[model samples]
Target: MTGKTVVITGASSGIGRQAATELADRGARIAVVGRHRARAEAVAAEVGGVAFIADFDRLDDVRTLADDLLFACDRIDVLANNAGGLVPTRTLTVDGHERTFQSNHLAPFLLTQLLLPRLIESGARVISTASVANRWARLRLDDLNWAQRPWLGGWGAYGTSKLETILFTEELARRTAGTGVSAYSFHPGFVATSFGHGSPLMALIALMSGGRYGISVEAGAVPLIELASTLDPGFPSGTYFDTLTGNGRRHRLAGDADLAAALWQRSAELVGCVPAR
Candidate 1:
């Protein structure tokens, strides 16, 4: 990764933070993006890179972040759309979208779309942090905001958002075909991070896994590091990686080609960007 420029969201902590450190050690220029200014700058200094602050809850912040990156880096070889959290309730963002759905999917979708041109030019890899919980998504394209069916604790909402991310990856890779850009998604293996706070679903997982509940933060970051650092992992663009499943396996419901296309167009409309197709 020497001489490569990598931009990682949610780098202030958890899997993203570990990847930023490891990638920086490998001689890449790190653009540490986080919601918190102090933590972002601290991580940037720790990695000898620059810090960018953007609240994923706001679309404007994401747009401004893209502009900042375009001006700060000559090329972006890797974009880790790893910034997200479990909202624990059916809440709304300032943008009037479901908080979990927006933060975990729409915001990153906007960021990726904004950077698509630069990524294609640099032959970059776009990596999204998805989850095994995607199986429980029960995704409804018409109910992306969960207004029709409510999951008050945010677990189901998180699942749907994750499913959306994988679908987004599929459409993204298809659109960027032959454009020298690749998109990958992966499950980070239930890392015991600051995420999922106050969610009963996560609590149940802890009980089910017993003593082996969650992996260490560093352990969870391995797959992300693999995809971001190199073009390896042996999976084609839009493929998803999960350690428990065969390589490139994703959720059963996450393979809808038509849905992926609809999602791309809908997301483009939501974020006010022209779909690259």
Candidate 2:
């Protein structure tokens, strides 16, 4: 990984932070992105890397971050779309989309599309952080906004968005074939990170687990690092992994080629970006 440039979102803390530090120590040039500029700068300084600030809730922020990255780095070896969260309520962004949908799926979708050319030139690897919770997703492809259905907290919405994340990886890998860019999605296991801001249950779990039952941030980040660094022979693309166990599968919907294609088109339309050919 030496001399390679890696960009990781959500690097202010948790798995993102662990991955950023570890990658930097291995001599990869790191760009740490966070919602908070101060936190991002702190992490960047620690790793002797650069910092970028972008809020996933806003598409404009994602666009600006892409522009900044393109201007600063000529090549990106690894792009880890690791930033995501679960909103407790059904909130909407200025883009008029559900908050979880925009943050988890659309933001990274746009970022990857914007950087496609560069990723192709560098033969980059794209890694999206998915979770086992995707099994909870009951995809409403017809009503992605959830406006038609009554609010049921935000877990359903969050899971659905993650399902989209996996689908996006599948579509991306398919589209970028022979372009030297590959995509991967993986479940990081039950990580002891500060995720899920709106739910009391998440807070309780974080507190009670105290990093006991849950895996440490370092352990949780191994899968991401491996995917970014290695391209083993016959390694599958457009696939979801259980963890670092050398094999994993996604939910049934996530593996549907037709659905992945449709979601890719829908997502491109929603984000107002052309899907990479």
Candidate 3:
């Protein structure tokens, strides 16, 4: 991995941070991205790489980030779409979409589209940090903004966004077929992280997975590290891996070709992205 440039979002903390550190230790140059400049810069300095600050809640920030990365690196060997979380409350971004959905799905989707040309040129691996939470998701294409759904707090919104993420990976792989670039998504397991601090759901998670049963941040980063390093077996593009089992598995909706296609179209429409080619 020496001399390879890898772009990792959410690299300021948790699994993302751990993965960035490990990858840097292996001599891969890292681009640490975060919403806060101070934290991002700190991580970047530690890893001997560059820092990019971009808040996913704003589409403009995502655009600026893509431009900065394209300018900073001649080639990006790996692009890790690892920044995402469940908002404690149902909030909306400036773009008028639900906060969780925009941050977790739309922003990364748009950023990947904007960087597709370069990614293909470098034959980069696109790794999305999806989740096992997709099993509980109830996708509502018409109500993706969560405008009409019965509010069950923010879990539903987060889960649906994850489902969309897995589908996005599938469609991306299909679209980028024969381009030498690969797209993949994976569950990072229920790691002990500050992912949803101050939320009731997070409180429950801490209680359930704390101590002897909890998965460490480094443990949760294994699959990501493998995928980004391309160390795993010859897994097909668009495959989603279950980190819990350490093997490829079909997500609840990830197998439906029609659904994946529909999601790609809907997501591209939402993010104002026209897929390259």
Off by over 4 Å in 3: 207-213, 244-251, 275-277
Off by over 4 Å in 1: 201-212, 244-249, 275-277
Every model's TM-score = 0.94, 0.95, 0.94
Inter-residue clash pairs, candidate 3: none
List, residue by residue over 6-68, the lDDT tens digit for candidate 1: 999999999999999999999999999999999999999999999999999899999999999
Model 2: what TM-score? 0.95
Q: Per-model C-alpha lDDT, please?
A: 0.87, 0.87, 0.87
Residue range with the least summed lDDT across 10 consecutive positions in model 3? 244-253
Per-residue lDDT of candidate 3, residues 72-93 (tens digit): 9899999999999988778789
| Residues 69-187 of candidate 2: C-alpha lDDT, one tens digit per residue | 99999999999999998888888999999888889999999999999999999999999998888888878878898888766778888888889988899889999999888888889
TM-score of 3: 0.94
Highest TM-score model number: 2
Model 1 clash count equals 0
What residue pairs clash in candidate 2, if any at all? Answer: 242-248
Question: What's the C-alpha lDDT at position 256 in model 2?
Answer: 88
